[model samples]
Target: MLLDTHMHTHFSGDSNADPAAMARSAIEKNLAGICITDHLDYDYPDEPDLFTIDFPQYEKGIRQLQADFSDSLNINFGIELGLQPHLAKKHHEILQEMDFDFVIGSSHVVHGLDPYYPAYYEGRSEHAAYLEYFESILENIAAFHEFDVYGHIDYVVRYGPEKNKNYSYDKYKDVIDEILRQLIAHGKGIELNMAGFKYGLGHPNPTEEILHRYRELGGEIITIGADGHAPDQIAWDFDKVPQLLKAAGFDYFTVFTKRKPEFLPV
Candidate 1:
């Protein structure tokens, strides 16, 4: 059974797609289930509340969908948290309060700047910028261990000036390996975000090399996500994910129910 583990709806500040419509679209694509991991990027550079959604309202809305679609598909409530070293306490508190089925920890900001904008790359070389991003991820996960998985381990590549043109896993294998190892040590996993393909990067986030490395280090809790914000984008390129995971030595993919991972054959 294929399940998309990351997505957003109207609740997320950056997205306005209705969750019910997103779920219906997933069913149309023949997906078994999907987890609605909406954005919750606390302390966003200029807008601290930009990605933060009303959890009470969001949870209620998702449960209603789960009931409405109970016979058609499984809908899991989840959240995507933007992690920074300084907000450890805040993140911990939020996680404790929510009843999320899955949590995706991501590094959307580093040193008070988001790499999505060109200014983040204005003076720094791609290598330096990418390295800093990887370092931030490691620090955030190490500081707060509340999330179930890390989202888009290679997110910076999607926005770099060259956009994956000169990026390679070999360039920063040491730090990348460290980050993977840390996640493994904390019993956390990573997601293969298909948004990289949508971004025209010719591959998914973390790429094949990092996926293989994670497996090589005994990390097995791997999930797949389209990172879609709109109905049309749900499960985008998912048809290719199974083969991709097999090449990385994975025979199964993961889903969460009530915060516990359930493995399904790929």
Candidate 2:
């Protein structure tokens, strides 16, 4: 009974998926649960207000779905915060308002600009741009450690101009190792975002090399997510997850309830 631990719905500014539809899709696929980690990237570059959400209303909606699916599917309340070094305090205020089941702290915008946009890679070589992105994760975690896991440690690769064609974990291991160590020290975990495959990267975010290294470094709390924005995408490429984690030396994966972790066999 694996849970698709990250997804989004209409509550997410970038998505218009029906919450009920998402849950139903999970149940139909025989998943034990799915966590709704909708977008909440405060102070996004151009779209200043697009990624924000109404917390109370958002909680109410997820709670309703949780009750509705209690008999068959498990749904958890979660949010994916776009990590920026400066917005830590603002994000902390929101997390205090609710007891979310999970939180994915991800670096969508590095240096006040999103890597999704071409401009972010325009001024520098892709390698330099990517290196700066990994370095910025340390700054973000230094400012805030409330998140349960860091989502898509290598998300920048997905939108890179060459899209992982020349990317390798060893190419950036020094900073990446520190990033993994920092998360372990702070008691935070990393997510295996399967959305990397959906984005045509032919690999998961953080890739196999990073996953293998995280395990070698004794980081145990790894969560799996599709980073899906809709029903059709939930648990995308999840069939590859169990074997992937196993090869990374993991025999278990993780789930969260009321901010507490519950380990389940993989």
Candidate 3:
């Protein structure tokens, strides 16, 4: 029984996939469940309106979909919050107001800039840009404790000019380790996003070495997600995930129900 804990629907500003359709796609792929973790990147760069959602409306739609798809698959309503240290209090207040089954905290913008835009990388070397992104992640996680797991730790690599050509866990092990240690200490977890393959990296976000190191640090809570924004992307590269988990010394993967984790054997 596979559970895809990360995915987006139309409620997310960047995606157009519908919740019911995404759920159907999951059932078609024989998945046991899927969480509709639409993006809610508050104060997004440039197009702030594009990344925000109406929580009440979003929740209503998700609840309807859950009832509609009850017999077909387990449908979970979740949100992917873009974490910024300055927005810690705001995020905490919002989390308290909603009753989401899961939440993924991610750093999409660093220093008021998103690495997805060329402007963010214009004046800096690839190493410097990547380092700043990691630093920002560490700071955000340190400030915000309302999220369940950190999404796409190395997501910035997807838009880099060289992509993953010169990137390796060894290059930024210090900061990455600190990020993992912080999450572990805070009782937080991380996700293995299969979207890396969609971006042509042939691996999950955070890569194999980071996953292994997380396990070595006693970080046991790990979930797998396709980061699927559309129907076709659901369960992307999932058949290969179990092997990756085993290679990283993870005998089980995680699933969340009512914000609590349940471990499933790999």
Candidate 4:
């Protein structure tokens, strides 16, 4: 089975999952490894609570989970960063100070507001909003190069009002191609976040089409993640992963440890 590279726990502002419980859940699913990628979004707008996280406590939690489940499955300490161009230095500093096995740079908010909220879509067409979101990704990549993989390149579609009904990779390839090229040039990778299926999009985030394009463009590193926030959600829809990659022209997927990647057969 593919290792789940993205997940969250109580340490993250948006989840209440216990680290031990999440570890046990992965063992039950027979997953060989999992990276407990808790949220770390510095300067998130409008949410005073902050997803920056209690680093000391969060590190302590994952360490304990690792000790308890050491023999059962590989539990890696990782983080999911909310990308904002201005916070690049802060993100780099934290990663340098920590011993994270992996880091997923993601854009949960764009231009000071989360697309999950209706206010972000208030006066703009969904198409325009989506374009702006992709553009923001370029700005972020330009500022930060410390992360190992880009999480859900098309995350905006998951919350769009139309919800990808009229979306296609070709529709935005003009910019999406550039995004893919930037990651390739930097030797970075993208993750196949299964939460898209849980969200009823009937496809993984970035979808199969983008995956194929990434491979076709000479990009090789790709990671698979459930983006699970709860025990039951761990590795959700994973059975489709192997074939999904096969259809996208990938014979292998990638996993990270100590900030490095190891390819696994699909």
Candidate 5:
């Protein structure tokens, strides 16, 4: 059975699908469960505070879906927090008041600039920008202990100016290794995000090389996610997931219920 731990509903500014629609899709796919990890990107200046979902309302929606599909599917309430070193305090304060089943820590900005915007990389080399992104993850590792897993480790590669053709783990092993070491030491796991496949990259977010290195470094806890924002994207390419996990030397994958992880064989 597959459990999709990263998903977004209408509560997220970029998506308009509600919790019920998301749950119905998971049911149709016959997934073991789905976690609604709505976007909580705190530092996006263009987005109003009201654009973010109220925790209470978000939780209530999930509960309603859980009850409505009681016998058919399991739904979890989660958040995908975009953490920046400068906003640690604010992020922590927001997290403290919520009851989330899973939390995914992600870096959407580096050096106070979001790579999604072309201006952020205008003066920087693609390689330097990539390195800066990885370094930011390393720097923030010590301050972030609120999340269960790291989302889209190589997400910057997607928005990079040079495009996917030039980005490869072999070129950034030094920084990637440090990020993995810190995550392992800090007890945080990485998520194998499948969104890259949809982006026409022919590879998952982190790529296979990074996963192999994570296992070689004694990293055990890993989660697989489609990072889905639409119904058809749920459990996207899940059939190939087990093979990737096994190749990485991982015998199991993880799921979260009530904020606790449950392991299942790969």
Candidate 6:
């Protein structure tokens, strides 16, 4: 069975697809389940209020889709909250008011700059930017406790101007180790985001080495996601997922219902 835990819908400003249409696409692809993790970014400068979704409306749409497609597929409601160190209290409050099945905490902005913008890396060396990105993730994860999983541990690499040819666990072992230790300490899972492949990059987000290290550090509870924004992308490249997890020493993949994990053998 296929499960895609990360996805976006029209509720997110950058997307034009709605919940039902996303569900229809997933059903057509024969996916067992999918979660609509609409963007809930707050305080982004460029798109300051852009890409944020109304939680009530998002939940309603998800509920509608869940009922409409109950016979064919399972529709899960989730939110991807952008974690800013200073906004932890507010982030927690906002999450408390919602009833989502899953919460993905992500770091999209570094020092108030969205890395997606070209200028974020204009004059800096790739090493500087990468180090800063890793540091920011450490801070973000440490500050937020309202999320079930950390999304795209190495997402900044995709938008980075230079390829991180020298990027490896050995080079950044200390930082990677700290991140994994924190995740394990907090009992949070890290997502295996497959969108890395779609970006023409040779590695999945966090790469294989990082995955192996997570296992070595006694971390379990890894979740897989396509990070799909449209229907055709649902469960994309899923055939390679099982092998990837097994190679990383993960014996099972995780699924969530009512925010609880259900393990399935890899």
**Model 3 steric clash pairs:** none
- Report every candidate's CA lDDT: 0.91, 0.91, 0.92, 0.91, 0.84, 0.84
Estimate, for each residue in 60-105, the C-alpha lDDT of model 6 and write its tens digit. Answer: 8889888988898887888888888998998889867888888899
TM-score of 6: 0.96
Q: For residues 32-75, what per-residue lDDT tens digits would candidate 5 score against the true structure?
A: 88888988876576654733677777788888888998888988
lDDT by residue (1-266, candidate 4, tens digit) is 77998998888888899888898899899999999998887777787466878889888888988898888899999999999998998888898799999999999889898888788788989999999999999999999978999999999998889898988988899899999999999999999899999999999998899999989998999999999999999999999999999998989999998998999998
For model 2, how does the per-residue alpha-carbon lDDT over 1-266 read when each residue is reduced to its tens digit? 68999888988888999999989888888898899999999888988998999888998999999999889887899999998978988888888877898999999999888889899999789999999999999999999989999999999999989989999998998999999999999888998889999999999998998999998998989998888888899889889999999999999999998999989998
Q: Per-residue CA lDDT of candidate 3, range 94-173, in tens?
A: 88899999999998989899989898889879999999999999889878878999999999999988888999999999
Better-scoring candidate (TM-score), 1 or 5 = 1
Q: Which ten residues in a row are the worst by lDDT in model 5?
A: 43-52
Weakest ten-residue segment in model 3 by summed lDDT: 138-147
lDDT of 2 at 159: 92
Worst 10 residues of 1 by lDDT: 47-56
Report backbone clashes per prediction.
0, 0, 0, 0, 0, 0
Model 2, residue 73: what's the lDDT?
A: 87
When summed lDDT is taken over every stretch of 10 residues in candidate 6, the lowest stretch is 162-171
Segments of candidate 1 deviating more than 4 angstroms = none
Q: What is the C-alpha RMSD of each candidate to the true structure, in Å?
A: 0.9, 0.8, 0.7, 0.8, 1.4, 1.2
Position 170, candidate 1: lDDT? 95
Off by over 4 Å in 6: none
Candidate closer to the true structure by lDDT (higher is better), 3 or 6: 3
